[model samples]
Target: MRMQLETCLAQAGGRSDPRTGSLSTPIHQTATFSHPRLGESTGYDYSRTTNPTRSALEKALAEIDGGARACAFASGMAALDAVVRLVIESKRRRVVCTEDPYGGTIRLLEQFFRPVGVVPVYVDTSDTRAVLRELDAGDVAALVAEIPTNPLMRVADVATLADAAHAAGATMVLDNTFLTPYLFKPLQHGVDIAVYSATKYLSGHNDVVAGAAVCRSEEMGTRLAAIQNAGGGIPGPMDSWLLLRGLKTLAIRMDRQQENAQAIAAFLAGHPRVARVYYPGLAGDPGHERLRRQARGFGGMLSIEVDDPDLVPRALAAVKVFAFAESLGGVESLITFPTVQTHAAMDAAIKDRLGINNRLLRLSIGIENVADLIADLDDALR
Candidate 1:
């Protein structure tokens, strides 16, 4: 039976313990499983290839995203690395991607993939015309987009981009880490692969560094499974169980976080020290209408540009509730300066063009008291 996402998530590992009825998924912490006899198997021979705990998490992830299958990895980069390998397998090895993706992604592509014949192409994915123009050149292997992008909050029309990619004989890969399956499911909107940093919102807490990739088709699922097995970047059983625990509360956490973000975005937009606010949740934001048409909610992320770059350090040092740290998506609010933190590896020119400058501060709103969160920012800006 098809259950609501909330129910599905809440019951992530609920049914995995049919044997002992443990309710919680047990961690099958072992390197290899012994067979009963020769030529016979117990389904799992090696933990690297598969494990009961990880399989349960993978199944939940696939179901939540409405994908054919899912693979869990040690980190978000590992999941992306495996996906990149699949894209580069094409004779046309050129992959088009979002112009301002997470810096770590750019580093992976430039340092690792570029040396091995994989060509990376960057463009403003929210600008359909520009992405279409790049695809028109042909010889494109895949189109990777980070919905609402990182820090900038630029939402792309997924179905339209997916159609264009398919017409050009290219696969569409979406980084759904920000919105996650709770707010948006890229596969349902014609995306062939949905990528995630399960470390963030999917895990909900500021713990467990994990990543996942969900495939839309069985063929792609089989291929990605092979790549996962070869790469051997799978997470341990304990980490997989942690993800399962995180999934159970995803719906609630996301709802409260979005609520807090909407209120905070409004607060930042009207603040004297704030020059610009980049949040799709704001009705006047450029991506607001498009994201509304596609996603269920506006998400919990927003970025602000201070009136003076000098005020950046003051705000960072002044925040009492918000943590001045790296990474996002957790119960505790986080403030990140993208220029030197998340997007430091990106080209300086691209960062300048995208407005990811020293004055810009990215906020990952958490499920805290909305008033407290607002007051904290308000005081920090002062």
Candidate 2:
């Protein structure tokens, strides 16, 4: 029988415990597993390479993303590191990337990949023509795109980008963190690989630190599996268990979070202190129509620019409900000054060019009371 996504979310780990009929997946927290015989194995030899709980989480991620396999990591950056190695291994050293990815990604590229001879060309992916120009220019091995870019909420034509990648003989890697599988499936949109920071929406409570990479085909899956085992950056069994638990309620969490987000975005759009609102959920946002074409929902992430850059600290200090934090997509509403938090590592020149500055604040709306959340922001603005 063909099952729906909502059904799969509730039953993330369908791999039931055969011995005790335990509904929850047990944590196999040992470094090594015992073998019954000298010539036999239990499928899981070492925790580093494989563990029951971790494998179950990987399976659930694969099922949700509609991929052949998923590789779990200790952190999102580690998963991205694996992708970089995978792309470089293809012998095509030149890569094209979206102009603004997470600051951590840019740091990794400049500090690590560039020194090794791999070149990255950055372009505004929201403009299909710009992306196509870069791809057509040649020698591009991969295209790493964030569905709707960080902080800015800029949308790119994923289907079109994937086609361009394929035409250029490059692999298309998508960061689907902003919109989890509940809102969008990048693999179905012709993306070769979809990576996620499971620490966010996948682990909606913000308790687990994990990452995932889902492959569109078995061949790619096998390669990613090799990277997972070889890199030794895999998450522990307990973290994996928590991620699986978080996935079970992903649909519900996102529903409430986004509901709050839409209301807040509407409120901010008309506010006197607000200069600009960056969210696809807004009817007049430049990327609103583009988002509708590729995703099910606009997501709970949004960013705003204050009327005065100097007032940023005042607002950050005054927020009562929204935590002045570094991360997002958790159960608690978070207010981040991207210029100092997420994008501080980015070059000042690029920051000015992209408008990621002191005036900008990114919001990660949670499953909190909409009215209360609004009141909290209202108090801060005053």
Q: Report the lDDT tens digits of candidate 2 across residue range 219-338.
A: 998998898899988999899999999999999999999999999999999999999999999999999999998889999999999999878899999999999998888999999999
Candidate 1's C-alpha runs over 4 A off are none
Instruction: State, as a TM-score between 0 and 1, how close model 2 is to the true structure.
Output: 0.99
Mind giving the per-residue lDDT tens digits that candidate 1 earns over 30-71? Answer: 999999999999999999999999999999999999999999
Q: Residue 51 of model 2: what lDDT? A: 92
TM-scores of the models, in the given order? 0.99, 0.99
Clashing pairs in 1: none
- In candidate 2, which residue pairs clash? none
Q: How big is the positional error of residue 37 in model 1, measured in Å on the Cα after superposition?
A: 1.0
